[model samples]
Target: MDLHSALIALRDPMGIPFFPWLFQGLMVLTFALHILLVNLVVGGIFLAVYHHVKGGEYGRKLSKTMACCSTVNLSLAIVLGVAPLLFVQVIYDPFWYTANAISAWWAMVFLLVITLGFLSLYVFYLKREKHPSGFGFFGLFALVMVVFAGVIMSMFAMQQLLPEKWLSWYVVKGSLQTLGGGFHAFSLGRFLHFMVPAFVNIGIYMMLYAWYFRPRTDFDQGYLDWIGKSGVRLAKIAAMIQVVIGFWWLFSTPIKFGFYRNPVFLIGAVLGFLVMVALIMVQKDPERYAVPMGIVSLVAVLGMSAAREVLRMGYLGQFDYSIYQYPVNLDWGSTVLFLVTFVMGLVVIAYPITLVFKLGRGTLSVEEG
Candidate 1:
């Protein structure tokens, strides 16, 4: 089917199919979850590495703590990724299958490589490995590499999914045009926009993690103080960079200006602005504004990210590389089903927040990383 036909099928106000709606819901949920995890891992590692390089006492612990968080986020990233894959298979099956099939050897091999990184991390944590100089460095590097692989896999998958007009299959290798890669499509500003905020988000969470894990000893207090300062500084710098790069990215995309028409995007931008400002303020006294602002900022950041993704996916829907089509109209039953699942997801996510608060209240022993 043509791109125009596919869009009408996707967005017809009249309704859509059961599987299509269900898969779309899964896609959105998983994509959002993956993005959140990306922030944690990407931003977390940068923060960890920074503190290590800057090595003060707190800098030492800060790096390890960030590593710990990065590990957890990596696991979450993998788990959350499953649903999106399934959704792609269900909704854009032919395209996904074709691209993945072509890249099958590499795609299959990536799993083992990613697992190797995680295993290495497990060993480090198991040994409680020391050396602030390299704390979390290898593990973070592994996770980042895995992310790059995923990006490539995604790019190839997407490139295949697009119809002939949006995409022209190139020469012998079947790889789409390249900026450079053994991985995802590395569009300069696009990737940087993806990268910078991830660092900021991770730093904020790490800062909040510091709050959750209060210092147990005088030494711990000294360490916590340093971690907090390092994290806040890194976060502010990263967020500022993201703001600049994000605008630059938008400026590069004349076509996407139409996509930003929804007021929600503007709201997201404003909220994102406030979030960084709050993150900056929190550094001064995390006890006062850091935690609260952190929560608000994280939510705002997530909202902004989600809004962009939704719009992006919507636009991609029209221009989907997938050469397939679903019926017009969202399946009514599927909408209800999605609502139920979404509520369940809210609860699942809420548990961590509750724990975060408990840690804050000292009801739960908030250990310093």
Candidate 2:
């Protein structure tokens, strides 16, 4: 069969199990959260680096602050990834297991590398010895390397495992060489484009978080003038860079033009564009717009990223993996269950807002009205 035909076959699963669409929705939600946190860590670190570098005499304090955020974001990146991964395995066990197995070495060593990265992460702050911001540099390096490894494995897995009609490794390599046009057959190219934006977005979020959680007393001219101004500038610039590089990476994939032709792909692309525009506007008027912009932009990002993953699972450009199929099952019970939780979640989210308003109101009454 032709390459495209083979690709479509990967999506042709034997059958659907359990509450298919509902589980898919859950998987999507969890995956989105995982990516959101991933960006925070990536962008957060570099922003911290930039802040510490520019803070002049305030460098130490700024570094310490940045370190705290970096560590927390890193932790969340790993911790919050559980549900999506489990759900992915449940549905795509063949693809997931096969991919990991082919790149077994990388997958196995990942634990050690992650541990080392964390050690570097801990050394970044836990120790006061050695170089200044010592661990920070190493931690940054380690994290980048680990992410790169994941990229390599993913590429190998996607092209290699997706039920390639049980083709042997050599035949696959031969075909890939003919198809990839002199590029390395097993390479994923994840590291080249994604790492910077990951770091940059995370940095932006941290700065944003700082801005969001600013103490009213400390919301003085200096804070706004120095930190806010500089932070906004860096984050927005990084945002622009991410947009550029993201497209570059997309096109770099063999899939390219046809990839965007997919309806789901188009939706993601449009939402992603909307998000960038919203973020830019918020950057322009941070106080009035930052919170909402950050939120909406994040949603757009998550949607785009999840769709991207779905496409990847389907092998967007080159081939669609046909090992699994999911029927669109309208799950009423699941819908009502999560719908109630969703509304309740809104109320829970509102509590903090209400408390903040109450405190601000009481403080304002004492001081003015």
Candidate 3:
């Protein structure tokens, strides 16, 4: 009847199918992959819109490229999202499902919003070449919708941790408010904390895009230089903003001393800041450090994700709940099979991305915008 009682009632009877740590690890890894692609899609949309409006031959080419890649990125984000969702349900089902129930309407609408967003992006891609002006509006519209969808999902995820507030959120004056009016609470700093770095990530990606095609394409040296220089500058600025946003989110969170002082949080926060510094430092010679910068960016994602898990656990500690407390069924056969299939699926999915990059090494023909 109470929040703690409700959560206990909702937990899976089978408990975790295998080791709790292992599932948690898989969730972090898969979620990192999902968010990385999400950054590309979100950040790629920003770049595409910026370049399209600039109205230059190189700008048009890059804009079109990013617009086209967005559809692919969205698909990959959806694909990579499934595993983490499953793992989350496996380990944190009580929290996850309760959050969904609190915001039931918005939770259901998330799928619809994604479908519409994807369709809008597809339209943007198709029209970008022939109806450039029309596509720009569509692109902007799609970006807003997709971002809203992300915000809703994030709010639900965070809402789960605040079990104590769940009942208050669900009922007011002895009346049920389960519909939630398509609204949910989310941290502005936390949302921007992820969104800002996405731009930096995409900036690094653009530099690599420029570098890879520089030798093959007949693109003007000035244009390629602009790509490299602009990307570095953009990444630097975004990284700086992310630092401020990161701290804002940190201070805003109601963390206990143990969580606030935990080495996991400390190390992750420090490493993330250092990674940004490294990215800024590498900007002086982007071409040489593009690969390393990209890898470090991913490492930052992993570190941040781990820190998030730490915070989640710490929050649950209030109710004296721990993922390790979940009963284990020890289904090793299914667990091993799932792990193998997950790895194989990643390999399969990666092949196409690798081929796309390989093919992208060719010169791009610019369309007049």
lDDT of 3 by residue, 12-90 (tens): 9877778799989989988888888889999988788888878788789878888888999999998888979989989
Greater-TM-score candidate between 2 and 3: 3
Off by over 4 Å in 2: 1-17, 49-55, 128-137, 149-153, 156-162, 170-194, 218-221, 254-257, 313-369
The numbered model that scores best in TM-score is 3
TM-score of 3: 0.92
Per-residue CA lDDT of model 2 for 1-369, tens digit only, reads: 875564344442544445555566777787767777766665555555555445454555555666666687777777767667776675655556555554456565666766776566666655523455344576566456546544653464455434544345425656632222211234334343345446445534544645554545644445444555555566666667666766775676556436656677677667666656665666655645556656765776666666656566555323543323444344567568866996898799897877675565344355533
Q: Determine which window of 10 residues in candidate 3 has minimal summed lDDT.
A: 360-369
Looking at candidate 2, the ten consecutive residues that score lowest on lDDT are 176-185
Best by lDDT: 3
Instruction: Give the candidate order by descending TM-score.
Output: 3, 1, 2
The superposed Cα distance between candidate 1 and the true structure at residue 180, in angstroms, equals 17
Per-model TM against the reference:
0.73, 0.72, 0.92
Candidate lDDT (C-alpha), each: 0.62, 0.57, 0.82
Per-residue lDDT of candidate 1, residues 212-277 (tens digit): 667433336666666567667877888888778767766654464464565766776677777678
Please identify which of the two predictions, 2 or 3, would achieve the higher lDDT against the true structure.
Answer: 3
